[model samples]
Target chain A: MKFPFLKEAITSLTKKPSTELYPLVKKEAPEGYRGRIKFHADKCINCGMCIRVCAPDAITRTIEKTEEGDKITFQFYLGQCTFCQMCADFCAKKAIELTKDYSMVGTDEEDFMVRGTFIKKLPPKPPVPPAGAAPAAAKAPAAAPAATEKPAEKAEDKKEEK
Target chain B: MFKKLIEKGIEKSPWLLHINTGSCNGCDIELVSVITPRYDAERMGFKLAGTPRHADIVVVSGPITSQSKERLVRTLAQVPDPKVVVSIGSCPRSCNVFHGSYSVEGPLDRYCDVDVSIAGCPPKPEAIIDGLAKAVEILKTKRRGK
Candidate 1:
């Protein structure tokens, strides 16, 4: 008589239950796990790379022109996100990061939104010329062209004479 | 009296009914794993019910395709009041990548109020457990209100 099953059955009784005590004892998501979108507005250049790479169109941007600059706001709706990490990968500035916080549970729609805002300052305008200098500045280029044209006319006349 | 005791009992064990509209099976697989031995959602008093009438929670996965939209609506209607609707993944919440497709009729809120949304392509088993635990809390309150 083979008692092969008896030894295995007895050892099973000593083995601990595989069930995880999740709620009571929190678990951490593994490293590089793409869970939630974290937008770094300060680092973002607003190049629209993340928006382009997003397959779901979960990323939306609104630009409001203010006295300071163009105020750009980016909204990442987690509800529509695929968590593909494409936005993070395409981001040139590393402004978008996929965090390991996988427990993204919420009741309100707004709760799932990740937003960031940044103001892009306008480039400095070139210094305007004074009234007196303006005429001289314009005349300088006009006179230089006339000076070159006179020499060319003289060369043409010499060629005709030859 | 006995009513309060029965209410408490009902709150302790909330049976779930899973409805797949037109999922890619990613979320469905993750949902099943939550009930497996390793994740064991039963330890928290969550059980999968065969029918909507028996369910205290409705777990909806997938983007609602035109083919499934009617059935989804009918099934949701069958669920009793005080039932919590839990969107299992990005699909049900806003249709994810399937948004604006010709067949998809969802982003589940257009049909009913979503009680809880667990956002992911297919949320981790631990995350599913977390969402389910939150649903149980909401269930307790809804029961007390009634």
Candidate 2:
């Protein structure tokens, strides 16, 4: 039933190349292409969601506070990451997303990690009292009572004036 | 004409070649399933080729990492002309998790042009078959033009 010579010639002549011109014609990638992890540091509220969800414990958040203010530091170790993308999905802050950029390779193990820092401004301090207005001369026990009575008398005088 | 006859022949028998750059092995597994008894991509005249030179379709998985970039490019170049490159999986289209790492050099589009991208961490076998079918259709068009 088969024409051997014609079949062989047709197959040989019709075989198209399997390699795409990847540089010229862009391939339409599928939906939800998980390529790379996109980081939105600005949107991160230091919630520790990404750190907690990371099964490999690849992420760590360090908070530092001083009399001046508070600073949040983030460390993401890609070497340990499983590339599960669970952290990005579970994150409530929407601070992280998986991008279609799968181009990660490093020779040094340490090169895979990333670190970021964020700072918060502190409030100003209250002003100190000026040097001695006679330092409020110490009053005797009896004088203390008189001093308290004087304030009461002053209040009464003000009431009368009003 | 001769071009139409060649296009018809190419549409009848298409060989696929797969490449795993640095993927999580998810897409690779699904691709293997295409040849299994369940899906049996072979029934459609689609067969897996061990070498790029014998293939008409290239199925690529994983993001293009610095380590795999040159090798992928070189291997792909070995494939014949009028080939269709299908990017299968989320990692190849986007970084997924390995994004900001210094070693990443992706978006695949930067390195080479992709013809069809099968989205998913690991696309189902049926989806892959569908994608390949579409690629074959496109191949027919290209052959017609040539």
Candidate 3:
């Protein structure tokens, strides 16, 4: 009887099973693992850089005009996401982050969506200039541009006619 | 009493039928790894079925391409009642980066209802296991209802 693997079998008898007890024992995804997306609405400047860089078009933005400011709502659809981290990489405000949570399992489509909202206040008007001064100040610049434009137009006409 | 016992048997061991409808092979690789020794998905009573008729859980990967759309629908229809449809990766759920391609026609829900969606470019093996566990739970509920 040739038992070629007798020594190997004896060594295997003492070895522990390689199978991971997955459900019973939870495991964490490694650091910098691009998984779920986290959008920081407050940190976002509404630059729209992330939207431009996203290959899947997973990020959607809706702007609503309100008394306070522009209410910008951004929706990140995880289902459509490729987990490429490009959106986070292009974000100028560091508003988007790819978390290490890999267990992004869900039944409903809504469950896979990540949303964030932020208001961007409009810039203040230039002190209003007291009403009377406003028209005069505005007229001065407006008239100056018109005056410069008329001369240029006349010169172009003369050239055309010649 | 025998009916209840049959249901119990079905709940304990739910066989999976993997269908790739134009996948880039990323999710397929991860799914194969899940069945390997290190991950060993079989320990949880999940087995890969050879045919759709024998499947209790249908794991669909990839964006449904124009060519594979018909076949995908036909395969799902064959998976008898009380079957759970699980979409692995962002491709099946929303077509991922392949959304606007002329050849791709998917986001799996258009054909059949997806019970569990595991979102990742190619989800980690652990995540795939988690999704499978959820599929198993859904399978139990479906079986009980039937």
In order, what lDDT does every prediction score? 0.93, 0.72, 0.92
Q: Compare the candidates by lDDT and give the number of the best one.
A: 1
Judge candidate 3 against the unseen true structure and give its global Cα lDDT, from 0 to 1. 0.92
Count the clashes in each prediction: 0, 32, 0
Model 1: per-residue lDDT, tens digit, A45-141?
Answer: 9999888999999999999999999999999999999999999999999999999999999999998999999999999886778988998998998
Query: How well does candidate 2 reproduce the true complex, by DockQ?
Result: 0.03
Q: Quick one: ranking by lDDT, best first?
A: 1, 3, 2
The DockQ leader among the candidates is 1
DockQ of 3: 0.67
Model 2 error, position B54 (Å): 1.9
lDDT of 2 by residue, A1-162 (tens): 877699778787888654443324445546776544667777777778788787656687888996557788787665445567888898888877766644333323344556777765566775544567334543355578998999999999999999
TM-score of 3: 0.89
**TM-score per candidate, chains pooled:** 0.89, 0.49, 0.89
lDDT of 3 by residue, B4-115 (tens): 8887888888999999999999999999999888899988888999999999999999999999999998998898998999999999998998888999999899898899
Q: Which candidate model has the greater lDDT, 1 or 3?
A: 1
List model 3 lDDT by residue over A83-120, tens digit each: 88988988888999999999999999998999999999
Checking candidate 1 for backbone clashes, the offending pairs are none
lDDT for A81 (candidate 1): 94
